[model samples]
Target: MDKYTKIIEQIKALEADMVDFKIVDFYGRLRHVTIPTTNITDKKLQFGFGFDGSNFGFAETGKSDFVARPVIKDFVELDPCLEDPTATFMCDVYEAAQDVKPYESDPRGILRKACNYMQSLGVADMATWGPELEFYLFNDLLVRTDPQAMSAEIISDEGYWGSQDDDYSFATRLPKKGGYHSVPPNDTQYQTRVEAVRRLTSLGYDVKYHHHEVGGPGQCEVEFNLMDSMVAADCIILGKYIIRNTAQEFGSYASFLPKPIFGEAGNGLHVHFLMKGKNGELVFHDPNGYMGLSKMALSFLAGILTHAPAITAITNPSTNSYKRLVRGYEAPCNCCYGMANRNAAVRIPAYATQPEEKRFEYRVGDATFNPYLALASILMAGLDGVKKSLDPEGKFGPLEKMDKGWEPPVSIPASLKEALEALQKDHQFLLDGGVFTKGMLEKFISDKMQDHLRIERTPHPVEFEMYELI
Candidate 1:
């Protein structure tokens, strides 16, 4: 009958015994509250369930009250791990009050506001983002930390050291830089990739393809078809959930940490985006321009490169993310664009010929990001570029070794603290059309700095390896 009734009917027909509501906090962590099916009601859908906002890294303890409402369209059945059939729905959060409104810090709401703001400015009708998510699957991971000792280790059946161990005689280990698209025996995670793809597509993710990434220690990647900004963010969360849980079921641990291994390629969530003009025409295509990108597209690229230091604060927010953003390992550290150049932070893919397909890829970001904040920040930067008519060609030259007077644009922020400081100094663009509030930016920076402080105080096991003799 009604929308809420239809949702209940679907859950009942699926034989779901429990309904789970999932939400994303400011730092992009997934949190959930599950209720038995018997508790499902139209009134509950309207009013939502309460949760402590402070626990979610948002409000302070004195003001920690929030509500979560189900996004019924995002419902899906759980994998067969549970004894009872369970359904899950991604949720939107609200401030807990007599007149509840969208929570300003709710990651999803932030993105929505960004999209609406762009339309209000008449920049574009829609934005589409395609992500190439990279990660690792380890056979096992161990960590031991105490006041007196700190140690850690990661074991991958595909690691080069495995052949020397007594467990396996077949030397299936891939070299540090030689794991991309390697065949079976060497690439032991092929079947596991298939499982992740099957689970993702079954849940409505348009997984284009999957393959082994360039890391010897079980690094992998999955590419999905482009979806609008909001849908892309939603799919990312779901895709990550599926990937992590799938790896667990297959007797492995999955990590999206940017730099889980040293001296090798790191995992990144590289995203490609294109926009639609107000006339409903794809705006990125221009055969006459460089890489068939429209003027608007180039301008968008300029915006992103100009604000990259601040954007890094949102896109690659974690401290480990900096390890991946550094100058080696094809990490895209330079603030330049090239035709399919892997070293440049932004590139116009030469393969995309169709107008709708022509887009630019930002290679600096990693999967540790909150997709909402990351995508929104990038879009706002691009919109600012369009407003300013910034010419990318003038900013940086084509991929070149060196020239007498040549210098790339300002380099990426060296660390999380540096990125945060950049955002603090130059975040006025994010305030355009009220897309990002001053409070949200301050809270985000304050909260994320804790991660940096936590790592700064801790002694890495590597430190002990070097300093124990000293």
Candidate 2:
């Protein structure tokens, strides 16, 4: 039998009761349709499946039809979270029009187009990225919001919020804001985090490690090894899926919100990544250069700095994201680079001295981001810098100028609306190579504006605290 036939036979052997065809919407939520094993066949596979795009925050009701074509290599035996004996695959969406092209609103397709643009520029065979995924596990959550009532509360098992009230002798609670790499007894989510990592490993992800982060309130981090741009994005999507579900299995809810707590630490998805040159050699490395970062890499970084204001719309996309990126938190808000400086938006890790190990950490983004748009926009920015020969030396980066009172090239937008406004003005780089079309950008901006307005219209209960006295 052919490759397709072999795949069908393999699925039949597994006796899968159902298969789920999944894809990510523009906002990064996984959307899927389940099909029973009996309905899975060659004819159905070749013709693709139909779905309503309007419901997915894509098209209008008039043009809602879209096609979902399965990516065969993404097929895997799913965790029994869904129906029993089930399989799932990630899919690419196609417009229902006559041309049958990939949908412009599809973030995955956008990333593919970005990769193609990079290859066309002859800068590198491919780019690579690794994300340090950080999140929170809340043991209890309560929210009451409406015209009638508004309130919120969260509790973490490892948090010292009310440890004195807990009578259990085995309770493991850390001090206020001091949960960094805490050992098993001190880290309440230790087994749950390990189980999540194990699930990822079983699914073929190269999970680096897992630990309690510095939130001191059940904040956790799981790091993964570097992979190619597209695969890395996929891994992020998949990794988040496994981690969240595993947390739920242990009776905790996983949240990727950048600042879930008021005064405690927040989550940031710091990326440590490198690119490969045309010859497949590491492009960021240069023995003669400072911090082993080649001149090309500096230029690429300059591109990122140039576009940092706009890229924030994609990286830190939420209104609450601004709460985590404020000063006094060491969450890089400056558009500059430095050697191992936690305060710098882009920092070259001092520990990575080997030629092959040369890579920079972008500390601005968080898990609230859509991995596809986040990485694609970042790659496009770097490519623009390289193409324009933008310099990150004294003019753009290199740590010393900040002390000399040299203003950084740019600053991060303080609000989601501000970031979207920057994106609206500086999205020409994103428009290059037709990766992101005008219509897509327009829709994204319009949809995100609603989020900003929603928060604006809501009345925070905190107003009552001060105003009631007046």
Candidate 3:
């Protein structure tokens, strides 16, 4: 049998009652349409399914028609979260016009174009990424937005402050900022994360490890092994889906928000990447270079550090993202780099000694990012740096060698508005090679500005606290 027939047989073996086509929206959310498995056919899968793109925030209503075509090679035999047995496949969005071209603004399409552009330039055959997923698991969350009263409360049994009135409570509660790798009673989400990892493994994710993070209030992390750029993006989306649903199944809620609580460790999505040549040789490792990084690697690092302010407009898009970048949270506030320095935006892992394992980590990003756009923009910026042969040595630095009181030349953007403004002024690198279109960048800015404005117009509880007595 051919591949199509084999896919049909596999679905049949899964006993799936429905087939779901999953597509990534402009904002990095997974939206889908499902059809009865019996109704699926080779032609329908090949031709595609129609959807309204305006609903996905992709276009105006009049020009909203789009097609989602299943990527046959990318699929899950059965979705573990849905009540109904379903076969799920990741899809590519295309225009519904007479020519049926790939949608230019599609997030996944943009990343795919970036990868292809890299190949065409003959710089590297492919780029690989490993994203460290960090999040919080809350036992319950309550929010009230009434005119008379506005409040938000987080309730987690594992939190030290959430102790019951009963005696001997101190022994069980995790101390503030002391939950890192704490076992059992202090780490209530252990089994839940184990099951989540089990589900992810069943779905073909190469999980490196899962553990409690430094937040005393239910913060958790799951790290994945390196994979190609496109596949890595897919994993980030699916991983979040599985994690959230798994949390729900365990009677909890999972949040990827950068800063959910004050005076606590916050979530971050640090990405590690490296490039390989057409002959499959590592393009980033050089025995004679600094920290075993080749000149190209240094230039790539320079590109990201150079464009970080603009890039955060996508990688750290949300208004609250900057809240996590504050001092004392281990988040990078400066554009400098250092070996194993958590305070630097780019950190060279001390453990990755082998040439194949050598790679750099960008610590400035958060989970608020739309994976495709974030990774693509970073790659584009780095490639631009490589093309220009930008030198990172004297400027951004190996921060460890700097004098004790020396300040870096640049800092990461302090707020969303600032980052967006930076992008508005410096997005030429993204426009090159047609990977990221001008229209897409414009829409992204317009939409994100709306987010900033909405937050600005709202009155916060803290404002009430400070002004009520006065």
Candidate 4:
């Protein structure tokens, strides 16, 4: 039997009542359609279901016609919720004609193009990624912005400051920066983490583990097992869905916002990547070399460091993102690489002992980014470096040694405006593989600039307390 038939039979055997086919848009939002189990057929899988892309910021209303082609290989069973038993599938967006795959505008298509382009260059058959998912769980959240009033508030039962509240008698409060791996009483989300792991594993994700992150107030992380770049990106979207749904089930909300609370640590999605050749040899590995890094690895690092500020415009796209990029927090403010340095933008982890494990982590990205596009852009930049043998010009510290005299490179862009300006100037590398087209770049810039303006025009709550008197 064909794969789709096997999937349908599996669904039938599982007695699944509903099937959800979802597409991740350019902005990384999950848009899906739910259908009864009776409709799970091979014809539906081949022809694909149609949807309007305009709602997803794709195009004008008139040109919004699109179809979602199910990727059966990416199918998984849904979490056990009280509502209905369901199966889920990731889909590719295509034009109504279905002959031509949608271009750069489609997030999935962009990822496919990136993979194919990498193959075309005869560089690597696949790219692998491991993203440390970071997020905050809160009991209550509220926000309002209008002509007469504007304010935002978030309350966490697990917050260090909220421990004294009457509702938190059972809670074990963590001190500031004390949340990392705290056991039972202090890690209030233990049950939630277990549920998240079970759900993610049920959905075919090999979860590493979930734990309380460095930030107090319910900050947590669920690390998935590594996968190829494209599949990893898809997993990221699905992982977020599982997190949100699981949180909702427990009467809580999960947010990936980088800086959900001020005066505390922030959430960051640090991605570790590996590039391997067709012979199954890691191109980045050299045992005798610096940090066991080959020349190609150094060039790849150079590409990323050179294009990091521009990459940040996409990787850390949100205005609140910059709030976490300050110096003292281990955020990657400096555009440099070092062996086992948490302070560097690109960190070569000391954990890798084998050729496959020898990978570097890019610390700039947060949970706000579209993983497919963000990863693809980084790959393209690295490919550009490979093509040009781009020497890292600015400042790269001692690869083998570090001393007080070795100053780190200049810092990454300090603000969204600066990051955007960097992107505007340095985005040619993103177009190397046609993974990110000019039209898409233009739209992204326009959308982000509007977001920047919206935040810029708004008055801060602190402003009323500080500037009103002045």
Best by lDDT: 3
**Candidate 1 regions off by >4 Å?**
74-83, 163-169, 400-405, 468-470
Clashes of 4: 0
Which pairs clash in the backbone of model 1? none
Candidate 4 per-residue C-alpha lDDT over 251-275 given as tens digits, one digit per residue, 9 for 90 to 100? 8888999998888788899988888
Residue range 85-174, candidate 2, lDDT tens digits: 777778888998877888887889989999999989988887888789999888867788878799877766676766434645345777
Q: Give per-residue lDDT, candidate 4, residue 22.
A: 83
Q: Model 3 lDDT vs. the true structure? A: 0.90
Deviating ranges (above 4 Å) for candidate 3: 74-76, 163-170
TM-score of 4: 0.94
* Per-prediction TM-score to the true structure, in the order listed: 0.95, 0.96, 0.97, 0.94
* Clashing residue pair totals per candidate (backbone < 3 A): 0, 0, 0, 0
lDDT per residue as tens, model 1, 1-470: 77888788888899998988888987788888889889999888767899998988888899999999877663545643345788877889999998999887788988998999888878789998898989998987887888787766788888876632566535678877789988898888888889889888776778888998889889999998888898899888888888888888789889898998888889989998888877768778888988788888898899999999899999989999999887768888878888878888897787888767889889999888999999999999999999999988856545653464566868888899999999999899998888889999998899889989999999877887799998
For candidate 1, report its TM-score: 0.95
The candidate that achieves the highest TM-score relative to the unseen native structure: 3
Task: Report the C-alpha lDDT of model 3 over 43-73, residue by residue, as the tens digit.
Answer: 7778789999998989999999999998887
Candidate 3: 10-residue stretch with minimal lDDT: 163-172
